[model samples]
Target: MPRVGLFITCVNDALFPETPKAVVTILERLGYDVDFPAAQTCCGQMHANSGYKKDAAKLARNFEAVFDPYDAIVTPSGSCAAMARDQCPHLTGSTIGRRVYELSEFLLDVAGVEDVGARFPHTVTYHPTCHGTRALGLGDKPIRLLRAVAGIELIDLPAAEQCCGFGGTFALKNSEVSSAMLADKCRHATDTGAEYLAAADNSCLTHIGGGISRLGRTPGAAKAPRPVHYAEILASTA
Candidate 1:
């Protein structure tokens, strides 16, 4: 078995720790040696996207140094994976970027394993994040994995390729536009009548999920769709 390093993104580390736990559960079941490098820190995605190139470069170097020894570096966040794969090479000039993969990419493309032996009895609508869809081109991998789960009703999310408006600093800089985009995404998610709204990136889920909660509080509003990470669902059991 190859040695794999789990690059738990800073967002998941601080806000959604369960995402990394689920990643480990599924990877271990697939028969891979997973290691967490304690020295690992933020992939500098926020800094990079916010135009702090110098700081981003420093963090990118730190990321390369920590995971360079591993045979493969896997992360559950597509945004972080995009940063490593797309931005790190330009910053650090290291080939380690090529070895980094998002969770779904690692499981489907690297491990060559599809059925993760999970079961979730609920209607699900998957939202494809911009970094995952445009940057990483992670088309259908997450959905295919969800479909393989027992007792899951995978519904199509309208405008599935549209941005959830949680583009890191984009949300902070353009709050109005971001809010509008998030509202549209939340509407689509609720329209699907799915109990859960799934996505590969928690950052996007955080934005959409917040909108869902706000909508639920409105008078005569429909039940909000709960945001769920793909890794968590894949780690579930019947």
Candidate 2:
């Protein structure tokens, strides 16, 4: 058995901790030894995306030093994994970069199993995050896995490939534009009448959930679905 290290990105570690916890639950059930390196830090995604190359490189080097020993590195985030796998080596200028697998691809490709014996009884509409769709090109790995889960009704999200407008610092730099984009994303999500809007990335979830929460308070607005990470649903049984 290869020793797997769980890279719980900063956003997940701080705001949405359950996603990583659920990642652990699923991997353990799949018979993998999951280790949390206490020395792990940010993958410099936010810094690099925000145009801080030097700072991002520093973090990338630190990440390499900390996680170099693991045979496989798994993360519940697509953007962060994209950073470590695709961008980190270039940022650090070394062959020291280890392949970082996002949750869905790790399960479908590496683990080679779509059904993790999970059972999620809910109408879930999946939102493919920008990085997961374009950068990582996750394709239907997430959907295929979700479809195999017992008792899960997966709905096709309208304009599913559209961005949720949470591009890390992009939201902070362009607040008004981000809000408008988020409005469209939220409207489409609620239109599905699904109980949950699931995605691999929680940064988008945080943005979408906040938008839905605000919109739900609109006069005569219908009930809105909750934002959930797909890993949480996958970790669910019965």
Candidate 3:
């Protein structure tokens, strides 16, 4: 078994801690040794997206320095994995970027295990975040894993390839456009009649979930689909 380091991104560490916990649970069950490097910090995605390239470069270098020793660095966030894989090389001029793997990619490609023995009896729909779909090219890796789960009804998300409009700082700087995109994404998610909406990146989930909640509270609005991180659903049983 390879020594895998879990790179829990800033948002997951601070806001969605359970997502990483789920990654650990599922990986451990698959018989890999997973380690969380306490020295790990932000991937500097926010800084880079917010036009602080120098600061983002510094943090990217910091990320490489911290996780370079591990056999493989696995992260639950596709956006962070995309950053390390796509941007870290330009920042550090190092090939450590190649070692980073997003959660589903690691399981399906690296670990080579699919039926992870998880069972979640819910009608779930998956949202492929922009980074996961376009940047990482994680096509159907998440869907494949979700399909193998014993009791999950994984439904197709309309416009599954569209952005959730939570491009790190993109949401805050372009609130009107971001909200419009998010509303459209939420409508598709709810249209699936899925009890839960799953995606690899919690940042996107946070944005779409907020919209779902708002819609739920609106007058004459139907129940909105609840957003859940894919890892959380994979970590569940029964």
- Global lDDT of each model? 0.91, 0.91, 0.89
Off by over 4 Å in 3: none
The prediction achieving the highest TM-score against the true structure is 1
TM-score of candidate 2 to 2 decimals: 0.97
The TM-score between candidate 1 and the true structure equals 0.98
Whole-model alpha-carbon lDDT for candidate 1: 0.91
lDDT string, candidate 2, 45-127, tens digits: 88898889999999999999888888888998989988987888789875644557899988988899999999999999999
lDDT of 3: 0.89
The CA lDDT at 142 in model 3 is 92
State the TM-score for model 3: 0.97
Worst-scoring 10-residue span by lDDT in model 3: 88-97
In model 1, where do residues sit more than 4 Å from their true spots? none
Q: Per-residue lDDT for 77-133 in model 3, tens only? A: 888998898887877787886889999989989889888899999999999988998
